[model samples]
Target chain A: MSRLTSVAGSTRAIRATHKTLSSPWATAGAIVIAALWTLPTFGLFLSSFRPAEDITTSGWWTFFAHPRVTLDNYAATLTATSGITVPQALINSLTITIPGALIPITVALLAAYALAWIDFPGRHLLFVAIFAMQIVPLQMLLVPLLRLYTGGLTVGGVAIFPGFAANSMSDGFAQVWLTHTMSALPLAIFMLHNSLSAIPTEIMEAARIDGAGHGRILRSIALPLAMPTVASYAIFQFLWVWNDLLVSTIFTTGKNAPVTKILADLAGMYGQQWHLLTAGTFLAIIVPLIVFFALQRFFVRGLLAGSTKG
Target chain B: MQAFFSWLASLPNIVQVPLVIAAFLVVVAVIIVLIEVAPRPGTAYTWVRAAIAIGFPVIALAVFGLEAGAAWVFGLGAVLGGGLFWLDARSTKGRGRLIQLALFVSPALLLLIVGLVYPTIKTIVAAFMDKTGNQFIGLDNFVWVFSAGGNGGLISLINTVVWVVVAPVAATGVGLIYALWVDRSRAEKLLKVLVFMPMSISLVGGSIIWKFFYDYRQGNQIGLLNQIVAWFGGEPVNWLQHYPLNMFLLIVILVWSQTGFAMVILSAAIKGVPVELVEAAQIDGASSARRFRHIIIPSIRPTIIVVWVTISITSLKVYDVIAVITAGQNSTSVLGYEMVRQFSLMPPQSGHSAALALLIFILVIPFIAYNARTLKRGN
Candidate 1:
């Protein structure tokens, strides 16, 4: 008891000393780093809201010099002008993203349940194969897919499922969905499996014994419990699909391209309206932010849920 | 040639239909059977599952012919489907098992097989063949990956090595220092948000941001960094056109974007470091630096490993930043960009590109293996 008391006393003294030593340095370092990290993003935000000419002529910090702000960049980015428009690109992005996000979540949930709870033959081997595919560079798959989508035939004249059309149904949101779904699978499966496995076995068994049935248990117990994770992965996939350039660029051609592709195209327009790219980028980020912040409570938990436990 | 032709002939008739609707069902069924029989042989349904697995593919082969019999093609698909089916079946009961599985997994699977898996197999096989994707070429393409300078071919391998080394280490170091400094501060949340802010920007946006920073001038300067240099009476350099320096600039963008990921995760681990342990160390007369090294670093070591390996894999696979920022020109070609350049975007060196991609996969395996091991052990 005397030793315990002494230890407690020492701990208190140590804590007090740590507080003294740490408070100022930690606070000062935090402030500096925070400013450094945020300044560039702030610059980006300011640039997006500024006129194109002002952006080209001065740093974003010069916004205070003008004493006023205008929405010309935003207006230019949103409206159809000179064969480019932000609103149309946004629509194209949504058409691509909604299905792109939905497909992987649905598939991974199903795959995760099996990997976690189901007793099946070759389960480990199949799991290994799925995991192995994670390393396969996504770029390696693009051409073959494009080939398959455009000119691929199993043997006869029957079109492959992702085949745009034998002649006319080519180059649109349909191709983006196909591309996004493939890339999202390995990671999605890995994530959902982690979460599903964490669920107590007894809960599943209890549902099984009560004649709750697999479908019913999944609906009532698993799905509801896993709601936060499903939402998180949905956001991640949505953001990834939205932010994608290469896959979208590869799969979709011309006007059917998503905003990222359009942004790249805007870049090539030789600084005629480079400010639109900034505005477009900001506009593009809003959906992801909404998805992320609205689900922030679940974001960290969802990301880390499958990776570790205690 | 004859044996290969015979093997091709044996694939099945569904190949003739182009769509392979029946083949898909049969393949899916075979997959379910393969999955069902693999995990728990103790289960009562093992033989039934095995029979279904063996039966469908065989029947599909017989009914359709080997011309379409590439189960190797469906092997990955079946595994994916089977895994989903088994999961659905486990949680499911009664008559609608197939329907529920189809509804839940098919939306993704149908697109995935067509988009990712099928094309991957096609590329792998194409790698073994000539550039036209006709006539088997064996190890010739693999040879070209190591050959001398030709259209930025083998140079990609070196550039990729440089990327794998530089980006992750720099990102982790900066993140660790930042995380350690910011851990208990009042501004922690704001600091993390700022660090993490870049994550919200797309790859091209990040490129544009840096492009402005590295913007060059003939004599006077307009860009931020160049202007600062001009203030010091220094000459403005075309930052993107320099060889190693250009590559380093590209690395800075990736490191900047990724550091926040490392910081956030490491911050969690740093917080997880017990207060009692640090207090104990302090009582034992450890300095702040010593306490950090002994107590905090040791505690968060597992997380550091995880972050490092994760970043390593990502750095190896990164393409977009380099693609957008430098277009893999100026000797900045890494494997990801080069693979795209050789195989898809440029003249399509399908074989050499596949070989290069395979090399990346080889390099990444040890890190991934280590990550998986650590993850399992940590759990």
Candidate 2:
């Protein structure tokens, strides 16, 4: 239903646009490029369905003539007896993703609100500091963090981080959530602040006069006004967490690994086994693709949020 | 607290459900009281505010449980903030604003410091230290990074340069051309999504999908490229095993993933081009290509630069696709993959890894500065 409306919307928008784009040359170019772009995924999708034996001997295009298919690859991949199973990894993805996406947005929203609405000391410096941290390479953080997580950080011979995995965080899932949330905070706060600051000050000031403090004003006026931005950033965070492999790989192993980590494990470790990989790849991407399709508008908005200068 | 965590963890779905609800009620009640009943600053209720602010979180963390700690950690600010507000309501101390903002932003700021800033400093310091990071070796790691013999760091650096130069220009070109071709066309939405869908997939997924295309068999060709080569009366080749061609093949994967981003941003910019300008060019008897050059291209130049720089940064950090496909074999390593590879060894090459990571950081600063400047002007 949404797809139909989007299609109709685009057609209407096309009519409003310069008709030169509908020229035969442009149309042909679009078709050719679109086909070239899509053919690889389509080929893989088709190969994923063919019998395991057929995948080794034939290209996906040949499957059209042979017309053999099976769900065995999916079954086999899902039912892996060792390492991380697909079902287990899928659950792992959710465990990390839900909290990872939620915690950052929750914390960032409050911070962004304070930055935008409150005339606080050092607020300007704080905003700049937070925003500037976005460019710090993830690599720089990984070694020290992994060291701290496992070996514990010591300064003058006293461990501060305690190597949490030695105790409570044995699952490794907690580390994934914590790292993802931390990594996402700067962008979330930056984007949310942009949207929050755009809201007219009068609305917030009016709430203050009505005897509403920061908490009440935030809950009632600011949050509702920032809903679209919140949705946008939430989708962004969701996709970032979903698609991440590096952070997941650094922190997780065994049963705790997320979808990308497991898929990467198969692709990288197994290397040449196409049947399970083709199937596993599809299974891994299905959620993110669904998310992208369902929340396409918000995703784009968030991607472009605060992207334009000044 | 340990027992509390175990109890919380061990509770089954059936029992934990109502427990969570009961816990939620308690938290909500505490929050309401903090909001509704806390007295103003400099009043009789100041001590109560300080106690709740300081004492509750300590209790929450030390005595109650992990679950309660998490809940109270969130309220730690609001509860303590309530007291701070009451005590400094008149701003006589001029610290109310500072305390209020600090409470609100403390969680995010603390996480950033721990997660990003401190580690960044540590990594920089590690770059100057030896592999064990216990002794200061100074400039040796950096010299090794630029040296040809040290872990092929120089090879990785050159390959990264090639990627930044080729991938961004190629991807942005494809994206710009697609955005121009599909703009306002009937199939625009579907076509854009087709180009865009690859992006939603992880880089590893893309590498595997494309790996099949480059997959070579000795006897009867199974891979698409091999089949095409064999059909055209040529021998099937191992695509990624080839030298310069392998780099291009890997770079193509980056382009495939990034083209959609470029297209979307450029398409938006193209759409913003005033129809009057195009119409005016048309009325003046200008050809479509001429109009595109004279009007549309000029209009979206900012978007073009953005897409280019965006893809450039992506290229500099191009690790996952290379990791999945080539594993830096055949001299296909970029800076990011090499850094990870260096760091992942048994004892780990701490200095080399940190140096490579810092190299990437330094390389990215100029692009970011340029982008930030242009974005300001565009706005």
Candidate 3:
């Protein structure tokens, strides 16, 4: 009887505190805002399935009243023609993304280890130089890179950079991967170095006293401890590479083009073709959306890392 | 050495590819042998180490091939990683630390030089050079960019200025209000996720979704916006067909995509505010609004700046949104979109395009510097 009375008293206190936060006005305001944010995507996702004529004649909201769905739009978009097929573009995206994600993370890890632990000459200057490189907009590099690929950069008719990739389309996959990896290096190094530097100096000292070399110390200690930071970056880089359109569009061609490029082209060419556009847009996002949800926590941390101060 | 590499590079790619790989492998083998035999960083071998470090890239570039640039980056990582294992076999107290730093840092440095630093200088030079780039044109490109007609660079500049002003404030405003609303609520996670879903969606996907919402028709409106207008007994409007208005609409798409980013960061900032301070204010008879203004805003000011500069930088280089929706048509163009368009033309306007690229870079510098300074203080 006494225990029950105490529980009731605590419940009353909890309600009293909670009531201050659960105001009717604030809850209703949040609901309205969330609805506004979500409804646009919700409406279009509904539109993607409606019959072509119905989508053009009626708002997607009306579909809630009179239901309809179909897969024809997806089938047509997926079916290969002279242009890109979904299968091929997915392959291209993987081809670009795998190398794009792996190369940078692997390279950044080592560079980060150097920057974080090893006391060396010019470390401060070098780290600053790399970090400063992040501000250079990639658009600045596209024209010269394209020239270097197509015409072999020349100065006074002397071949300064002999165009190495003889076939434009053949080398597009490699070009896309290399450029993404390059652009990612500065931030990757910075973030991963932050994670590496966070390890306790005493732990490192203990490892050194035990005769652990830099490589063993990194492999055993830093890598294991910094796994979360690594996973955060890996997911971030994977999604960026997968969703990337600009680098892929500029550097790649034919079969090498990512899905976003084809969809963007379809959008321009068939602007009024709602049937194709809605289906194609969803198709392009499904992979990323899945990846985003599966790794939501890591993705959030990764996205917010540099946006907030340490 | 140049002639030797040029001759080696001229061989059939099949032969050249294998030769390059074999040669790289042999060098690795030799480096390992040298490290084991001569494990000291303080000897005459220091010059030999430095020479090899410098010589590797030159040989890789001159003899290996450009296709191998990706492989070179990949192999460089492997070599350094492997070197770390080899270097670890030595004693701990030696200045072998310097050698390890050089080994690890050099590959990434080489890539930065090739990828970012060189291209930046090239683009700047291209800005001053003529369309053919045979002679210096001396501000012709800049004049073209600031001129009022064609894919009017002045128009893009104005639109960009508008975007920079509007997108960040609007996004931050919406974000701040939403952050305050859901600050410690039970539904905070769900509500925040609902808004932030758009951040994960590609800018193109968001544009397409919004495009449907803005989809125009002369008949019974299909788009939600037009439907709302029509239900109110008004004419269905082409939202993106109008100038200045279309630019704002583009800004709306950016805000929609970015507001969640702002909200997430700001909400975290708000959560960091001490509960004792807020309670103290309340006990001292501060209203909700005043409590927020005096306590919360001042606490998260750095975060607000960070979010502002980030979105501003994004707005200045805004491309994918404009590309997906209007393709920079009908006064919705930005500098980035125009740069892409100019570069892709038959007679590619490399000069003017490079100039536009440089303009975006110049705009980004101040924001980045400000961010770096503030971050330094924050840390």
Task: Give per-residue CA lDDT, model 1, range B1-379, as digits (tens).
Answer: 1232223224432231222233334544444444333334344554444344344434433332233445454464456545544554464343234433344344345555665677777777877777777889998887777778466767888888888898889888888988877765556676777786676667767776676667675744536777777679887778889899998888888887888878877766666566678878878999889988888898888888888877888888887787666777788888888877787644567777777767777788898788778877875
Q: List DockQ, one per candidate, in order.
A: 0.28, 0.45, 0.38
Q: What is the interface RMSD of each candidate, in Å?
A: 9.8, 5.4, 7.9
Model 2 chain B weakest lDDT span, ten residues long: B60-69
When sorted by TM-score, best at the front, the candidate numbers are 2, 3, 1
TM-score of each: 0.81, 0.90, 0.86
Off by over 4 Å in 3: A1-19, A80-82, A152-164, A167-171, B1-59, B66-96
Tell me the tens digit of each residue's lDDT in model 3 across A1-310: 2322343355444334335645567767887989988988888788889998888888888887999998777787778332777656766676667768877887788788889998765878988988899899989888777766556655455454555454243343445656887899998999998889889999999998997777667778999998988998998898888877788778877655777777777778778888877877788788888988899988777766656634
| Superposition TM-score, candidate 2 onto the true structure | 0.90
Which regions in candidate 2 have their CA more than 4 angstroms from the true location?
A1-17, A153-159, A167-169, B1-42, B56-90, B93-98
Which lDDT value does model 3 have at A112? 89
Model 3 pairs whose backbones collide: none
Q: Which one wins on lDDT? A: 2
Could you list the CA RMSD of all candidates, in the order they appear?
Answer: 8.8, 4.9, 7.3
Best by TM-score: 2
* Sliding window of 10 residues with minimal summed lDDT for model 3 chain B: B31-40
lDDT of 3 by residue, B63-166 (tens): 43333334554456447644544454353656345455555666677678878888899999999988777789999999888877746688887788899999
DockQ of 2: 0.45
Give the higher-TM-score candidate: 1 or 2.
2
